[model samples]
Target: MFTYERKVTYSEVASDAMADVAQIVRYFQDCSTMQSESLGMGIDFLAQHSHVWMLTAWQIQVMRRPRYFEEIVTGTWAYGFDSIYGYRNFLLKSSRGEILAVANSIWILANTKTGKPERLTGEMVQGYGSEEKYPMVYAPRRIALPKTWEDLEPFEVRRSDLDTNNHVNNARYIDMALEYADPGVNIYQLRVEYKKAARYKDKIWPRIHRENNKLTVALCDKDQKVYVAVEIATDEN
Candidate 1:
């Protein structure tokens, strides 16, 4: 497992002075990236080898959102790898060691040039040894979409939304989906399934469904084919 400590900044918090769910996910993402960089398998190394790790799904559960300026620790570890797929887990904790959030993620190793999945070799994962999966009720990688939803105003993907892969960042999809969520609802769990990469200038037609405390958003193209699907569970029903 790899861990890092940092204080929540104003920019990472919501109006309620608590860290936003998207920011929590960012901390987890950054921790994993930092671990890869330390293991000599960072972004530069992957790019040089024409390889990229594509995030296929995420399951995050928030116990409590840390307040602004609160110091916290974020940790992550690779739990397993099979063929071209990798399974990892993440945790966010307060300074006192209370778990704020935990996450399980799935990634696919793919050839950047050919867009083909690459099988994991011994050398490829030698540095990052597998560890036990986090203690959480793991959600499936696939999120079931509702048959009906209300369409919202579509928006174009901006350059700022792109990460090093030149497509929408994984966490950005959560940020977009939250725009259609109830402001009063405090999300307890979040799950995302990325179907396709939304590139710069691609218009995303958001379709939302609300059932009690749960909210689902499907970010899609004009044809309704999804780019990403997000499901949110709040505290209240």
Candidate 2:
């Protein structure tokens, strides 16, 4: 029913000079993930029902991503819905409330075995605040397969990538893999698994593959172990 906002901080950026999408994903993910829990229809709730939410798709628009340390307000609330997907809207705004970026996401609560989303329960639906607005996206109109970027000779894991537990941030790996593919500006759906962890000073190689509209991005370590694997699906605007 309401949205939240925050300023853009340096720790959220990929580099000092620009506001990278990776940081944006971090900010958005944190907000959306929490919103899911607040409504009692997210992770914790799904746990009781024997399901996990997967991000099947996303739509993003960058009107004006803020520069480093710029104050911004980030807002998120449940919006629209369809038969199988729930639509969540997120917005980034200036301290004065000017919109900076907008994102629409599609998620499913699936049965782990069948991998199909069951219709959301009445309670779950109401909890998410999906009442009036419902935005529909044509998911069948898929993203074309992107050419794989088979080399990752330049990227390196910095100390900051590690968290308090001394593991690379799960989300950052998804960003690194997608960046190597350079699969155009519009990145929509991403499905990834955190197979293993890579530490600081580790040389990383990104392996990319595409089939139809789905792109597979994987980050491998010096030992050729897969630390991260992501499937990118999109329809370029």
Candidate 3:
């Protein structure tokens, strides 16, 4: 288990001064990157080897939201890897060691030059300590969509949204979806499934559905091809 400490910055919080869901997503993303970097398989390392990691799915359970200036510890481990995919799990805890959130993610290692998935190397597998275990377990697959959806405002992918991969960073998709979310809802859990990459100049169509305390949002292109699907559960009865 690789762990890192961080103080929730004022800018990381939303209007309530609680760390936003997107901010937690960013922490999870960074923790995984830092974990791999510790093993010498980070972005720069992999890029030098002509490879990049693409997030495919995410499942996060937020027990409690951390507030501004709160010191938190985030840790992640690569549970295992297959021919083309990697499995990871993460945990967020307060300074007192109380668990705040847990997450599961799936990623694929692709070749930059060919854009094809590259097989896992023995070192890469061993370096992450595949045997490290965590209690949270979820299938890393696409979330099923409903037959219909209510369209929300559309958003354009801005230049700042792009990462080193030239696609919108994974966390940015959550931010976009949340922009259309019901402000009254207090999300306790969220699941994000990334279907395709959206880049600069791409316009994303957002749609939302609220069923009691649960909310579902999906992002698609003008052509109706789905990009990211988000399911959220709020703290209401």
User: What's the residue-level lDDT of 181 in candidate 2?
Assistant: 52
Candidate 3: Cα lDDT at 102 = 89
- Which structure among the candidates has the greatest TM-score? 1
CA shift of 78, model 3, Å = 0.9
Candidate 2 error regions (>4 Å)? 112-116, 131-141, 146-170, 181-237
**Going through the candidates in order, what is the number of backbone clashes in each?**
0, 8, 0
Q: For every candidate structure, what is the RMSD over all alpha carbons to the true structure, in angstroms?
A: 1.2, 6.7, 1.7
lDDT tens per residue, model 3, 138-219:
6447777777789877878999999988999999889888877788567877889988899999999988877777778899
lDDT of 2 by residue, 1-237 (tens): 445656566566544454666666677778877777666666556767766665655555556657777777676777666666677777777887787666666676666556567877777666777644424343432233344446556477898787543567656676676575553444544445555567788878877776666567767876666776666656443
Error of 3 at 28 (Å): 1.1
What TM-scores do the predictions have?
Answer: 0.98, 0.62, 0.94
> What tens-digit string does per-residue lDDT give for candidate 1 at 1-237?
899999999989999998888999999999999999988999999999999999999999999999999999999999999999999999999999999999999999999999999998687778889999987888889999999899889999999999999999999999999888878678989999999999999999999998888999999999999999999998623
| Cα deviation of 2, candidate 1, in Å | 0.3
C-alpha lDDT of candidate 3 relative to the true structure = 0.86
Whole-model lDDT values for every prediction: 0.92, 0.64, 0.86
TM-score winner between candidates 1 and 3: 1
